[model samples]
Target: MMNLCYNMGADLWNLLRTGGSEMKLLICVLNDTDKLDELMIKLAEAGVKGATIINSTGMGRTLYNHQESALMNSLRALLDPDRDENKTIFTVVDEAQEKAFHKVMNEVVGDLARPDSGIIFTIPVDSVTGLSK
Candidate 1:
């Protein structure tokens, strides 16, 4: 089972339908930037209409690159001569599409429980404007 880390309650889906707020904001921090294209393709196949990607680097990468310590800098230079920034993807999906989204994410990125894989999470969207149906 996928660990979503959030409890939307047992009647969450029903509440979403009745409350007229079935939309959820799904965010994913993709560590392996190389897999971005494949992930996008799989997400489209899984019914995600649109998503936004931001080029971002984590704190560790930032420190590794800028740290004054010669030892850490030397290690960084030796280990990762050319490192890429992570891709942070954001999308809004309805209740039904949320499951498909997670499924495809796992399929593309593998088990997130593994180290350095990636992270995916969702937040309830109360209201959305400027979005097309």
Candidate 2:
């Protein structure tokens, strides 16, 4: 079983690294939901043809909302509970476009390094079958 798991993991890694086309899956989680529209526009301007967006909540926010601990409740109160939910966007783009994509994201999202702004990351895509232009 261990060998099988290792083999599977290795295969997946290899596939992602050597995918037919140098593709990357970019994911962005935005704390400010109002920016979604502007983000989409920026993405389009950056040459992203397709993407998916979903409403999501962070683990910390979820715990703060559901847990009954006074500490968690107090933390939530301090953090402004209304802005806990975020929008997550996923898009597949050619690896060559990474720099432009990031530039556009920064311009629209205002430096991911800042707290509570959001997070953006990328993963190599091994294969994409049904993506249309």
Model 2 poorest 10 in a row by lDDT:
13-22
State, as a TM-score between 0 and 1, how close model 2 is to the true structure. Answer: 0.70
**Per-residue CA lDDT of candidate 2, range 74-102, in tens?**
88778876566899888887765667778
Full-model lDDT for every candidate = 0.80, 0.79
RMSD, each candidate, Å?
8.8, 6.7
Q: Please give, for residues 1-133, the per-residue lDDT of candidate 1 as tens digits.
A: 2334234443464455535647889999999888999999988888888999998888887875675687867877688754647889999888777888888878888899998788888998765656665
How far does residue 133 in candidate 1 sit from its true spot (Å)? 2.6
Best model per TM-score: 1
Q: Please give the lDDT score for candidate 1.
A: 0.80
RMSD of 1: 8.8
